[model samples]
Target: MDSRGLIIGMIILLQTTVGILGNFFLLSHYLILYYHECSLKTTDLILKHLTMANTLIILSKGVSHIMTAFGLKEFISEIGCRFSLYVQRVGRSMSIGSTCILSVFQAITISPRSSDWKGLKTKAPKYIGLFLSLCWILYLIVNIIFPIYLLNKKVKSQNMTKAKSFEYCSPGDRDGIMDSLYMALFVFPEVLFSVLILWSNGFMVVILYRHKKQVQHIHSTNVSFRASPESRASCTILILVSFFLTFYTLSSILNACIAFLNSPSWWLVNINNIISMCFPSFGTLVLMNNAPTFSRFCFIWIRNKKSPNFKVAM
Candidate 1:
């Protein structure tokens, strides 16, 4: 491989590795908490779903980008291409939707007792499963149409008159109607989810500011700055939303131009995938910083590692 290819491949490999491992650890933490700890909290359940989706994104997008980066052409068959893109799109959408739900739910959780939306605090947890189910169903159904129109790079026409190409896959057919449907099915939900994420984050920020002021007012000189679990979770949502929106917006813009670019550069395609996966890669570590259970789990793990079980030499 050339220098550029080598560098791109290495970067993708690192991202994929970190994203997969981090997400798996987070997912396991939540699962253990759910089964061993009696029951999972509502927010933890949402995070479990988010972590699962991030892992899916890593598997779908990371593999394709790595193969493309190192010039592994046509290694994937048509069915593989279809499945990859379908999984990629669905995972990306689900990740965004979960983040949106998380931010909104946290906002509701932290709202003042007198707030009009306070009742949701009691009722929202009941519907989380339904919300997640709908999210999966919506994205899966919408992206299901792409398989028939996708081709492995090997079989894709050099000049299908008009085509949208990815590094390892291409649209076998396209018309105005299909294009409209693509925007409707894929882009619209992404846009909606992003907006919701922003709105919820904003709400949480406002709530936090007001709460801080109230705390300060009551305690003139000796107020505790230590944040509560709700505050920390709100901050996590804010960071996650900020990180997610920045990359999500850039990826969307690049995706819009992919169909128009006569031949997109190597850097262009891989960079788009990189941006799409960036939040998933780093977001887990961000959550880890805030997750007390994860910290405790790590602490126990390291202590155990430092003092391994062994028979002393007599």
Candidate 2:
């Protein structure tokens, strides 16, 4: 109820609102396309998964933060804490994994015909469903550790040296074996996917550069050095991956600091939560802007509404 708390609540409220609207719009747009077209492109499928994951993440974290900010943490029972944390972790992992897959898929799709990865371009679309299923299973197994140690306990007036799973939950039990297992299962996959995203991004950049050189040499006048659709898609994926990495890294570092501090600031914890929520919140808008079809529709809709006499050219 203090000024700082109010400010944080307002910020989270804004993020939650924007995130819900953007993600809902993106998801609904794709659903309409899939329903009418009777099938989805590979990228569209991946995007649908990403939007679902992002929406869950926003709801889980955003609502929890708002409740805490408003001094209504009691509503989150022990079961609620366990379920919300588990869902949040799963959603976070899915966001990372799906984005990584999307990047790699684009890399393969845009690979040179002579490249080894070129063969996957035709077969990748067939396996997207399987890949997404596996991702959910993997993350679910990893986060099953949540409810084991998460307890709904009141926050006592005591200095803490580490972070708890939730504001209303007790500090996580100190089991070295469980801690190591969690790291291996949770952290390992995140690091692996992040590395894959970076590698795929680099490969796509190199391929695009070489292709541009070839196109220029073949016809300096006939071909303009404009970004191809593949290049634009790759760039958008790269931006998304970069943003996720930045936000995740910052939140991780802050969490680490909080773990070591003898007296962790509550505001710092709120800030970390806010940072964790940023990727899902703003990343949807990035996807909307980068999507040509959606962007065109939005442009035409807005322009026509604003100027009744104006017409958009196809």
Candidate 3:
């Protein structure tokens, strides 16, 4: 009815749509990965796993958010809350882990043959499953205590203090320390991944420029696309990194606004929190679709063609 209500509604609508679409596309990717032998490359597997994690995270948070929007805060019981929270946290953490690994993997893949990282390509594929397994186990262990301590069906009123907030573990206990430690664990990895992604992309840009100059020196008349699919995969990775950075910045700014405003306006707070989720939902769709090079490759091959390249071989 008011401007704030309108904003919240729009945010929910956009997030729900994007979540549905993204999940569908993720499922499609999984099916392709499983059925297509040629698509079983290590990077494809990594992206598939990342997509799966992203889908779960979206589903867990998006469903709860929709219920909250619809005035159904108690849509799930206490046990449900614990389970949902556990799954959501694990899924979210796995998404972060996968992205971090992907950045490092890309950097290694692009390294020259003389570089030490060139040897990593042989080992990385073999270890992808191991990395995924470790992520699942680590997050599961860290999150298991949540259901034991925090979730209860006895609904408490939303008080003015953050002190009364629902928690699976006591802030005074070892669980609190573990929580802080888990947050710290992600900080360095996240920063490292972000930096590696930036650096890898920078190097690729410079190489492309130099390659273009070399081509021009030959007095070539035809326009040439120099990037291989592997290089294009790096571009996809860059798009993903950009997507993550954009929302991370936006959410951080909005979170700071909420903390500083210190207002008791329920509608305003709700809208603010909802915006943080909505943009990422939309962003996942954009990033996935931005892989035009991949899409064209898929289309040509799926059509039973040998190659997708017009002027050269794919």
Candidate 4:
């Protein structure tokens, strides 16, 4: 491999390794919790789904790029290409949908006692399964086109026509009508989810601000301003949403450029793949930082081994 290829391969390997480990730890922690309690909180259920999706995203995207970078693209067959792309797209859609649901659920959970949506807090858990089921169904339906059109064909040159193809797979046959329909179906749901997430987070922020003001009014002297669990959860979800959006938007822009450019740079393709997996890799660590149980477990173990008197501030 050339220097550029070697560097890209190393980066992909690093990202895949770290992402898999972080997500595996998260999944294991929750599985243990679920086994002991025999029930999952609504948020926990959403998180479990998100972790699973993130793992698939990392695996599908990472393995493809690694294979390309290492000149092993010939190992992937047409079926493999179809399956990988299908799974990647489905996982991506699920991540977006699950995050939106999580944000909305947290907003409802933390709504003021007299707020219009407060009643949802009591009933939301019952519908989590339904919502997740719908998410899977919706994404599966929208992305079924992948397997129909994707082929394992080698590209001889890096030209505009082949820029949309993966290293081991040819770009799927594109019809104007089908492309328009696909874009409409995909964009509509994504835009709707984005708006919902933004609205939910915005509402929670307002609630937190008002609560802070009320607390200040109630205790004029020496008031502790510790964040509540709800507030912390809201903040974490907001951060996750923000990161996902940023990465997704950048990837979309790069993809659009690649589509239009007569000769897209090979490095741009590598960068796009790297950006695509960033959220799944780093977002898992972000989540771990906010998970009280996981954080506490790590702290206690580290403390016992290093300093007996060490305390976790959170």
TM-score for all models, in order of appearance? 0.88, 0.86, 0.76, 0.86
* lDDT by residue (tens digit), candidate 3, 1-314: 46654566567767767776876775676566466544466776777777777667667766766566555666687567667777777776677677767767876776667766777877887998788888878877866765655543233445324532222211212245455664576545556666765676667566556655765665646765555666677777777766766666665566456545545356545655565565436645665676773566457446654544543233
Scored by lDDT, model 4 comes in at 0.80
Which candidate's TM-score is highest?
Answer: 1
Score each candidate by Cα lDDT.
Answer: 0.79, 0.80, 0.62, 0.80
Q: What is the C-alpha lDDT profile of model 2 across 125-168, one tens digit per residue?
A: 89998989888887788687766544433334453334454454
lDDT of 4 by residue, 203-260 (tens): 8889888888877765645765677787777778778878878887898888878767
Worst-scoring 10-residue span by lDDT in model 2: 152-161
Candidate 2 — which residues are off by over 4 angstroms?
149-171, 217-225, 297-314
Candidate 1 structure, TM-score to reference:
0.88
- Native-to-model Cα distance after best TM-score fit, residue 275 in candidate 2, in Å: 1.0
For model 2, state the Cα shift of residue 50 in Å. 1.1
2 versus 3: better lDDT goes to: 2
Candidate 2, residue 196: lDDT: 91
